[model samples]
Target: MTHAIPNVLTIAGSDSGGGAGIQADLKAFSALGAYGASVITALTAQNTRGVTAIHTPDPGFVTAQLDAVFDDIRIDAVKIGMLANAQIARAVADALRRYQPKHIVLDTVMISKSNHALLAPDAVAAVRDELLPLASLVTPNLPEAAALLGEAAVTDEAGMIRQGEALRALGAQAVLMKGGHLAASDSPDWLIQEHGTLRLGGPRVPVKNTHGTGCTLSSSIAALVAQRDDLASAVAEAKVYLTGALQASDQLEVGSGVGPVHHFYRWW
Candidate 1:
């Protein structure tokens, strides 16, 4: 029997460098053989070095973009990233509640690798209150996790798990605590669920072209989950894909500072 292609929607910002946000999300969706759609929430004059300026559209226009996509396309899953402020977060949350997609991967993006602040400080509460409950999974790196929980960034694996649990308590059905910030030989991530926590470990790729890693991974999982894979399996597969992208990242010379992973490494 012929099967329809899975449709994945990414609600994110625009990256002029094309290494992250909506650009990275669509690349990941295509790499995973899913149809990708996007609703841009903000625009950034960004490069690998840093963000020079950011322009946020009104929240009503964000809602309009959501309406435009939901009205026509069959969105199987959604990957959310880079809500610029409280109003946009609430607006996106309202749209998600109305559409009720099967899988929603919330990437709690607060800061860029270049140390540029992406989410407003006042928006953290809105993310916890409105977006967390609607998310199937929330992927937060150490700092983002701590900011969400109103605690210090964790130093060890145990602290990561604790923060993950606390985030789950805040209403995210599951939490993927990313441990890339930790100083270790291997990169580890904990997937905390209602039943138990899963440890995903992989060797850290020694490459500087690691821009947009979070966006790529979350969108990959959303695409796989849209194809009907279980959450754990999808996470595992996405991890492997990310590892490969990181391993091959050096091949692409995209920018002066940090660069993007090879989204089409398998093909190219």
Candidate 2:
């Protein structure tokens, strides 16, 4: 008898640049040895420089895709990103309740690297109220966390820890608050759980080719969780994988602008 490979589903927008969103998630899933599937909520005409245009798919279509994937595939985990609007967010929340995947890793993507709003301002509450509670783990960068909390932006390591706890209080089952925006010496992600807390640290690769780091990290976590039994172990494993990917990102000269993390085959 052949054993089935673990499956991870990515529900997000398509980055025409191929560095972020559904593309990045699928790459992370496959690199980690999981079968990858996707449900695209929007289409982004974007590149390494910036997002130029966005087209949101109909909410009904999003629901149909969700149903099709859930009905046929034995999805072990779902990594959610870039729900174009509140309608799409509600559809995703409802599907998660219905199909009940074993793990949900939500990357609450808000803004892009070149300072474009990815999620509509009207949709913030839907993500917080509707989608957040369903998440087994929600990975929010500094700005996204502050937006969800409806508070001033987190500015420091101390602020990251505090807001991470605050976001957990806001109904996420678990929280991973990233300090990527912090002007600190190192990039640290504070993981807040029910039993305890952990500060997962990594070398801040001083490279401009980090276009998909957030999506990559969250999907890596989802992929690892799908293949493992422990949440802490998954987070730890993801941290290692992401740090290496970031370091290797500079190795790939994909675009004239900011490039992407190499879906590396070797460990240096």
Candidate 3:
């Protein structure tokens, strides 16, 4: 008997650095054994150091891109990132309402590691209101979680659990609250879905190239979901894969400032 490779779609921005956004998502999908496709919502003039400028395609073009992919291929899952503006966010939300992919992992990508704003300041409400509701899972770091909730940043495991519940109340069926920002002993994340909550914890890899950790983790979950794994199982597998990639990041140097995680760590 023959089998088909899972097809995962990433609708996000372009990172000239090749370390985050659409690039990282594609790399994660391929490294994890899934077929990947993309619709670029915005383009950024950026590198490992920081982002300088960003340009979002006309929102109409974004819709066309989504249609082009959906009309042609059957996407098993979708991963959304750096929408750039309310228009782009609404476009993504509208597409999700239309195509209704089996699984959607929305990484509420707002601020870049270099302290640049990926999404416009005014677009925050659109993301919290429009897009959050459609996602099968919403992956937000501490700051993003706080922004979505209009509260102070969640700083501990208990805070994460509370915010995870709050995020679900905002509309996401599942919430993965990433604890990478906490100055804690380990990297802990909370996954709250219809099922019971799971606390995912791992030793923090002491590496500098964690620029795309959030994108990588969210895309990894989307890829696993596309491959027919359950939501909780997908989250668990993605965490393991991201940690390994972080641990192996020291093995490669793509740029001078900060580097990217070794998305293909299994190869080396």
Candidate 4:
């Protein structure tokens, strides 16, 4: 039997290291059997070590890129990553409003794995005010959730639910509160929505080569959601794929520092 593949778009920066950003998103899309499109909002000179320099496209150019993709392709879903500043964030939010894709997964990428500041402090407002209301699902780490709500990072399961509910109030239909930052043997994530919360638990993979785990997870969700009717199932399937990728991450010798997960782990 033949069927059309879902087309997923990633609006993010370019990671020269290829471990994260547009590169990782496209890889996840392909690995999950979805067609991928990209709109580059910024460019970074980075390796697994850290981001050294960043170059952001003009907001007008960002809008142009969005128009170019939406004009031609039927985008089934959108995975949004690093928006360099307020202008770019506003631009992306506006385009989303116009095109109105069925699913938008906003990965609140505030800092890089190596502690590089990806989002400008001023841009937080744009993301919270304009982007949050438009997202179908918002994926935020502990620090990002805190940043979004202007509070300290939560340290327990109760705090995760508290912040998740607050984030949902900000207009996103659902919030996935990631607890990978917690110092525990098991990694826990909570999916918070209007009706209730769903807890997803996984053993933490003991691997240092997790350079793009967050990017990979959010994009995977976006890609899977494009095909499945149920968001929870898509999220669960995405997590399974990510866990497998993380377990196999050490196989790839990409860089001297942190390395990328095996996106095509099932293949060569």
Candidate 5:
């Protein structure tokens, strides 16, 4: 007898380095025992060093991909990443309006791990207006949160909670402010809700192979949600999975620069 698996969709860019973007999301989904689907919005000439260039796919083609996926598949959750431009962001927003999947995890991928700008400067408002409200949870790193709020000092846990609260006020039901970029002794991320905030803390691993940690975490949350976990439980489980992935990444050498996490570490 065949068993049915939960399906999760990732709308993101293609990372040539295979460390992030759609590649990472698909890996995380499969690692979490979910069926993964994708709608690529941009292609990047990137490696561990940096993104040399980016080419945004046509908005019409992006919509076409979404239509194809939603027209046939029963997508349980969606993990959105790397909408490189306003047009792509608008298209994705339209698709979200059309499909309206049960759980939407938005990874506000403003900048890549290699220090390249993934989202345009002018598109921040578009993302906030079109996507953030539609997302069940918005996961943004320190820099992305700063960019979103136009504030330069959201670098601590208190600032993160404030920023998360501001983002939730802007319309996100929940916010997960990632602290991996912060230079703290204990890297503590805050999950802010209407009720209160829960701090998730863990020691920072001294590993350079953390290129796709954000994408992986958000995708893992989406996968867990697809499996019917509640929002808080899904986020908690994804954090655990990401911590393990980071700890187990020491064994692999994918690239000379920042490398990919070991998504299948448990199996191997």
Candidate 6:
């Protein structure tokens, strides 16, 4: 019998539309040739339109799921997103401390694609205090970076670099400040920190299917890191993958609103 591939685990919320959150993370891992596992933190009544309701799973249950996966599976990397409350945040942090996985990619998912808040105000502090420090890399879009640092805006590349360095000080070994939602420019996303900074700009591809871009990007980075890619290389590859996915997204219509990027863009 053939042996199974190494696994990557995602601890995140469930997106009913299958566009983002755990769904997108798992898909990205699979498309990138890694086995995927998940411990769901919350369930959102979400679709392409927006999130109508959110139900956080019991923290104990969340913990149990993590224990089950870590105790048996060989999780080479872990991607974290959308822990809706302080308890869930603490629960996830506790699991990470116990497992000490090789890589922890934190996608600070503060708001949904439709502009709905996915995280609570108090939970932001929990994420900053408990979670960010534990991350190998934290991938935050402009708004999330601003929220994490209590800044009003991260309006430009220089601001992103400053916020990225500040996030590094908060405990992340590195930071990938996404430039997608930043002021429009010809630049690719910027990855910055005290160690170094790399501008990952590619030709901007116009597409409406971007609901899962952040989840897919972070998970792709985790997958590459699991396979021994250095921080800069992994991020670069992830950017290429995301751009292709976005460019190919013109053909897919997963929902009425913003659809999902094609995780298997390379395949088809």
Most lDDT-accurate candidate: 4
151-239 per-residue lDDT for model 1 (tens digits): 89999999999999999998888999999999999999999999999999988899989999999999999999888658998999999
Which stretches of candidate 4 lie above 4 Å from their native place?
A: 1-3
lDDT score for candidate 3 against the true structure:
0.91
Clash totals in order:
0, 0, 0, 0, 0, 1
RMSD of 3: 1.4
lDDT of 2 by residue, 1-268 (tens): 0236788999999999999999999999989889999999999999998899999989999999999999998889999999989999999999999999879999999988888999988899999999888999999998898899999887888888898888888788889988888887898888999887888887788877888888998999998888885788899899898888877887777878888887663543
TM-scores of all predicted structures: 0.98, 0.96, 0.97, 0.98, 0.96, 0.96
- Report the backbone clash tally of model 6: 1
In order, candidate lDDTs are 0.94, 0.89, 0.91, 0.95, 0.90, 0.88
Report the C-alpha lDDT of model 5 over 148-254, residue by residue, as the tens digit.
Answer: 88888576778889989999999998999988878777778899988899998878888778889999999999999778557888888898999899999978888
lDDT-based ranking, best first?
4, 1, 3, 5, 2, 6
Q: Considering lDDT, which of the candidate structures 2 and 4 is the better prediction for this target?
A: 4
Pairs of residues at least 3 apart in sequence or in different chains that clash in candidate 2:
none
| Model 1 worst lDDT run, 10 consecutive residues | 1-10
Q: What is the C-alpha RMSD of each candidate to the true structure, in Å?
A: 1.2, 1.8, 1.4, 1.3, 1.9, 2.1
Model 5 lDDT-worst window of ten: 1-10
Cα shift from native, residue 240, model 3 (Å): 0.9
Q: For residues 1-268, what per-residue lDDT tens digits would candidate 4 score against the true structure?
A: 1347999999999999999999999999999999999999999999999999999989999999999999999999999999999999999999999999999999999999999999999999999999999999999999999999999999999999999999999999999999998988899999998889999998899999998899999999999998985789889999999999999998899999999999999996
Q: How close is candidate 1 to the true structure, as a TM-score?
A: 0.98
Error of 1 at 43 (Å): 0.3
